[model samples]
Target: MKNEKCGGAATPRWFGYALQSLVYLAHHAENDVRCPSGEIATKVCTEATLMRRILARLARANIVEAREGRDGGYFLRKPPETITLAEVYRALEMTEPLCTGLMDTASDGMIGMEIKGAFSGIMKETEQLMMTLLEKRTVADLVKEVYEVKK
Candidate 1:
């Protein structure tokens, strides 16, 4: 669960599902191993419908490709090494960050404005740091980490 929220409204779980789907695909990335949504959903423990939506977003980002018809399925359009965690975040449209943004958006006068302004600055800085770190990590890097843990 990569996109776990700390507070505020809960984040859509699509990002985690998308990452897991990418990681799953990365392991079988070579030679264009296309797999159906059912199979991927089964492996990732998510609904097929949600997986389809997530995969559609990834495909739109050129991270994955989809084929139609009976033999149709999904395959990585780009190599795992070229796919960064930041790319996944971007693909999922996670521009608004989680955590840091406290207080409701009720606009409680001058004090509220000042508080929100400060929180906005902090949120931006925090999100920037997160993206910087994520940009350094790729799907291949994560796959390697998983293998290491398994060993």
Candidate 2:
């Protein structure tokens, strides 16, 4: 069997889904007043249940609002141009990088501490950079970028 590491210290799944769903909602903002969970799942190529869970998280964060019953669905609580990736990141509480390794405390006592400090610094810097980028570019910006790329 291949030693495939699953669900390591990576960004939580909800973060990616929230980001993707935000972008999608922003792109369809003009046309899509309210998007059902199934539609969102289809567009994002994710399972309905997964999408629902993601949407629920976003809703909890106030990034998106959910409505129940017929003609009920999800919609961006705020304009996409105002939404930032940092907001989503914070909402999802994703702190670690995409990949991380456990510190070997036995081999090196101080080394682990040093590595952890360095990693913390790097993460803080990365988070700030991402926040700055996200602040400047909103969901609409993502839509524009996507359109340009598709063209």
Candidate 3:
């Protein structure tokens, strides 16, 4: 597949782009400032149109608020500390994880079916663990991480 705008290999390129843009905004959201999509595009290195689409989805999720006219732009709907990475993941991802095929029962025989069941169970538990971590982290946490890294 073609590389996504933000250089991530996620099935849909926009997922990574959206998260990167949000991180950028979270870091730069000083004074409750609203920034235009084009400004965000330049900072995050994506096309302005893609930023608009991503911002629109975030707006619908109430992760960000969109404004209109000359002074119009996008701003976080809530404080960065209040928005979990899991919330953004839900807004950007529209499908189950790519391992869903493992969830299907194998018609080959009892062994194949049993193996599929075992694999599916493991995958399900792993996914839940990942979700738990994401739910525990927020945009503000990510910003704090960057500051810590710089030290």
Candidate 4:
């Protein structure tokens, strides 16, 4: 619905935000500094509330850790190279196949049922393929990509 280039339905909007935040964190991590949620949100150009929500998910997944109080914020739990994109995707708890809603428009007749079934199978395969690709990449990889593009 929104006109944002959020990687569309194949990738959830927060996923992009999360990765960007992670890359930012990873960079600051090299300086041994923890990043505040507001800073990360500003860098990613998103609301602090939404950024916190995404960071909470990442924390729960053990991809990042959060601290409380004056010097508290968030940091990666593991090195960026060790954290795969697939882990981030799973951390977001995406329960359904991407674009599954497209199949919901099928008719109520037998033909519709068949089409739905076919779509279900296709969606499952598509998700599997996507996961396979994501598993090979990591936050560090994305950071390198961003730097390269800037060069």
- On the 0 to 100 scale, the lDDT of residue 130 in model 3 is 74
The reply for model 2, stretches above 4 Å from the true place, is 1-10, 95-114
> Per-residue lDDT for 1-151 in model 3, tens only?
2324532222345656677778778776886777899998887777787678778878889999888898888888778899898888788664556355566545368787668767877878977987899899888887788666898
- Candidate 4, TM-score vs. the true structure? 0.82
Clash numbers, per candidate = 0, 0, 0, 0
> Tens digit of lDDT per residue, candidate 1, span 38-125?
7898888876776787788888899999998888889889889999999988887754565534645625888887788777777678
Runs off by more than 4 Å, candidate 4: 1-11, 107-114
- Compared with the true structure, the alpha-carbon lDDT of candidate 4 equals 0.82
Report the Cα lDDT for residue 52, model 4: 83
* Reference-based lDDT, each prediction: 0.78, 0.70, 0.75, 0.82
Among residues 3 or more apart in sequence or in different chains, the pairs in candidate 3 whose N, CA or C atoms overlap within 3 Å are none
Model 3 lDDT at residue 13: 54
After superposition on all C-alphas, the RMSD of every candidate to the true structure, in Å, is 4.9, 4.8, 4.7, 4.3
Q: For this target, which candidate reaches the highest TM-score against the unseen true structure?
A: 4
Error of 2 at 82 (Å): 1.1
Q: What is the lDDT of candidate 2?
A: 0.70
Residue 20 error for model 4, in Å? 1.5
Misplaced by over 4 Å in model 1 are 1-12, 100-114
Residue 25 deviation, candidate 1, in Å?
0.5
